[model samples]
Target: NTVPIYEGYAIPHAIQRIPLAGKDITEYLRGLLKERGYNFTTPAEIEIVRDIKERLCYVVHQNFDAVLKESVENTSIEKTYDLPDQRSIVVGNERFRCPEILFQPKHAGLEIEGVHKYAYDSIMKCDVDIRKDLFSNIILAGGTTLFEGIGERMWYEIHQLASSNNKIKVLAPPERKYSVWLGGSILAALSTF
Candidate 1:
C-alpha cells in the first residue's frame, strides 16, 4: 500500500485511509499475514516504507504547487475592448497547448500533452511516401477540436512544428466536431471503410 501510494498513485488519500480504517481488503490480508507468524518483517521495513510513501506524497504535492504557480503567473485572460465591436478578448498562452509537454513533464502536471504529437509520431512510422502524404493531409477529426479558433491555432502550431518546406494545413469539415460521426455513418451506409 505504502509503496503504491509513494509511486505517485493518483488517489493517495483513499489509499491511506483504507488500511487505517480496515476497509481495504488488501490491508486486511497484510494484517492476516502479520498475525500468522510472519514476524520476519522487521520494524525497519515498516519505517522504510512509511518514509518512502511520505516522500512521494510530498514530491507530487510540491510539483503540483509549482505548476499551479507557473500557470497563474504566466497565463491570464483579458477581456479588454481591443476590437472595434468592443468585445475582443485575449487568452494567455501556457504550457498546456504545447503538445511536447505531454510526453515530457512541464512544471508539474503528468505528461500527456495532447494528441498532435502522438498522431505525428504515429504517421512518421509509416512508409516514407505514405508518411509524406499523411503529413500533407493531416486532419484533426475530433469533437474536442471544436473550440472556435482551434483549427487556425492547430494549423499555425503544427506548421511551425513540422518541416519549413512541408505544407501543413488543418482541414475542418462543415460542423467540424461531428464530421467523424457523419463520415462513419456515410461509410457504414455505403458499406465502405
Candidate 2:
C-alpha cells in the first residue's frame, strides 16, 4: 500500500528456495488423473494433463481436507475438461488436491516442507527487528505462483505461523511468471546494481 523506499535482502541466510514448483504440480495432476481412471501414459498425454493443471488446478483457501470434503458435498468446485480425443475428464477434488502438494509435499511422497514454511523460516532467520517488515513485504513470484488463490493461501499459511499481532502481505504481480527476467532487466538498466 505504501511506496517502496528501499528493496534489498540484507540477510543472505534469510533467503530460501522451496524444492517444489509448477512442473511438480503438473505431474501430480497427471497422477490424480490416473487415479480417477484416466491413464495418461505417453509424454504427449502428460502435456494434456499439464494443460488440465493450468486450467483446473488451484490452491484452496480453507483447510485442504475440509475443502476436499466440501467439494464432494458441494460439487461446484469440480470442473470437466475436454481431451484431444473427444473424451473428457471430470476434475473434482483433484483440482485443489494437486496443488495441495505445494503446501503438503507428503502427498507427493516428498518429505520436504511447504512453500509457506520456507518464507516463514526465511523471516525468522533475519534480525528480530525486521521480521515484521519482511512479513508485510513478502513477494511471491514465479510460474508456480500463477495458480489461482495461491497468493491468498500463502498469506493464510504464513499468518498462521506468526503472532496474531503481526500482519502478512503477499505481492503476486501480473507478470510474475517473468519475475526473474523483470528483476534482471531492472538491474541491467541500473548503472550499478
Candidate 3:
C-alpha cells in the first residue's frame, strides 16, 4: 500500500486535529505525559525528552524488523491477506472468513476456524456416551458473545455446523453482558475452588 507520511513544519498542526475516541491528539498526549511522571520544569526539556524517547523507540523497532522478517520465514504456515471488500477468501490452508461466521460456521468445519466455532466445538466435544450424563447442560458467556443477535446466531450456527448424526445445545444467559462476571463471582464464592 502507498501510505503517506507527513514531514513538513506544518505536520504538528495536522497531528493536533486528529481525533481519537473523541479527543484531539495534542490533548491526549498532554494528558498521557502528565500521568507518566512528566512535569514541565521547562518547555524545552519536555520537547527534548519526548524527541529522545520517540527516536529511541523508533530505532529499537527498526532493528527488530529484520529479526521479525527472518522469524516469520521459518514458519511453514502460509498466511492470508483479506482485503477490506473481500472477507470470505482463504489464501492458504487456513480459512479467512470474517463476519460471515455469524451465519455459517459449517463453512469452516469441525476443527473450529475461529472464536465462535471454538465455543460451539467445546460444548459439542463433551462426554455424551454416559448412561447418566450432565452433557446436555452447556452455557455461553462473555462480552464478545453479548452483541445483538449473537446468541441466536451462535445457536443456529452450531446446529448448522454439526454432522447429521450429531446435535448441539447451547444455552445463553438472559443477561449475557454480566454472565462471565457472575460466573467468576460464583467460582470465588465456592469453598472448593
Candidate 4:
C-alpha cells in the first residue's frame, strides 16, 4: 500500500510508491507466456493474464532461488490452471516471481528500492522522536498487500532495518483494497454539518 509519510506536525516527508504492482506483474506474466509459445493478443486473453495473477501470484519470503530453480527443472512446484476456454497453463515460478517484483523491482527491470526500503527510508527522514510511533503504526492498505505472505514479508524486511527498541507493526485490514474509499467516507461523515 502506497502512502505519503507525514511527521507529527503533519509535515510531508516522503511518498512510498511501488512501481511494479499487479498490472505490471500481469504484463510480466504475459511476456513469460508469450516466450513459452502461448501467444495472446486479444482483450479476453489479457483478462486471463490478470485473473491468473490475482488468483495465483504470491510472495516468497525465503528460498526464492531454490523455488525458481525447481520451477525451471519442471518439478512438483508446477500447477496447471485451467482457463475459461478449457485451456490450461502450467504456473510455477511465475506465481512467486511476479509478486517478488514488489520486493525486488530489479526483477521487473525497474531501478527502484523495494517497498520495505521505501518505508524505512521515509520513516528515517522524519523526526527522530516520532520514528517509533511511525514504525509501530504501519498501515498497509491496497490490493497488492492482500497477497498471501506480503504483510509478513513486509514486516520482516522493515523489522530488520528498525532498531531493537522500536516496536514494528504492519497491519493489513481485511478490506484493505477499499481502505482509501472508506477513509474518505469517514472524513466526509465527520466533517458534515
Q: Which candidate is the best by TM-score?
A: 2
What lDDT does the true structure give each of the candidates? 0.39, 0.82, 0.37, 0.79
Q: What are the per-residue Cα lDDT tens digits for candidate 3 across 71-121?
A: 446543233333233642222211112222323333323223434454444
Please identify which of the two predictions, 3 or 4, would achieve the higher TM-score against the true structure.
4
Sorted on lDDT, highest at the top, how do the candidates line up? 2, 4, 1, 3
Poorest lDDT segment (10 consecutive residues) of candidate 4: 1-10
Query: How many pairs of residues collide in model 2?
Result: 0
Clashing pairs in 1: 102-112, 102-113
Indicate the TM-score of model 3. Answer: 0.36
Candidate number that wins on TM-score, 1 or 2: 2
Candidate that would win on lDDT: 2
Which stretches of model 3 miss by more than 4 angstroms? 1-112, 128-136, 165-167
- Every model: Cα RMSD to truth: 19.9, 3.4, 22.6, 2.4
Q: Give the worst 10-residue stretch by lDDT in candidate 1.
A: 16-25
* Predicted candidate 2 versus true structure: per-residue lDDT over 1-193, tens digit per residue: 1112125534766667677878888888888888889988789998998888888888988688877777778978778899888988789889889999988999999999888887888788777887778888887777778899998999999899999978899998999889879987997999876
**Candidate 1 TM-score, true structure as reference:** 0.44
Instruction: Please provide, for model 4 over 1-193, each residue's C-alpha lDDT reduced to its tens digit, 9 standing for 90 to 100.
Output: 3454444234354555555577887888888778767776899998998888888878876667887877787757667889887989887777788888777888878898888898888788777977888888888887777788888888888888888999999888899988878977886788552
Question: Which pairs, if any, clash in model 4?
Answer: none
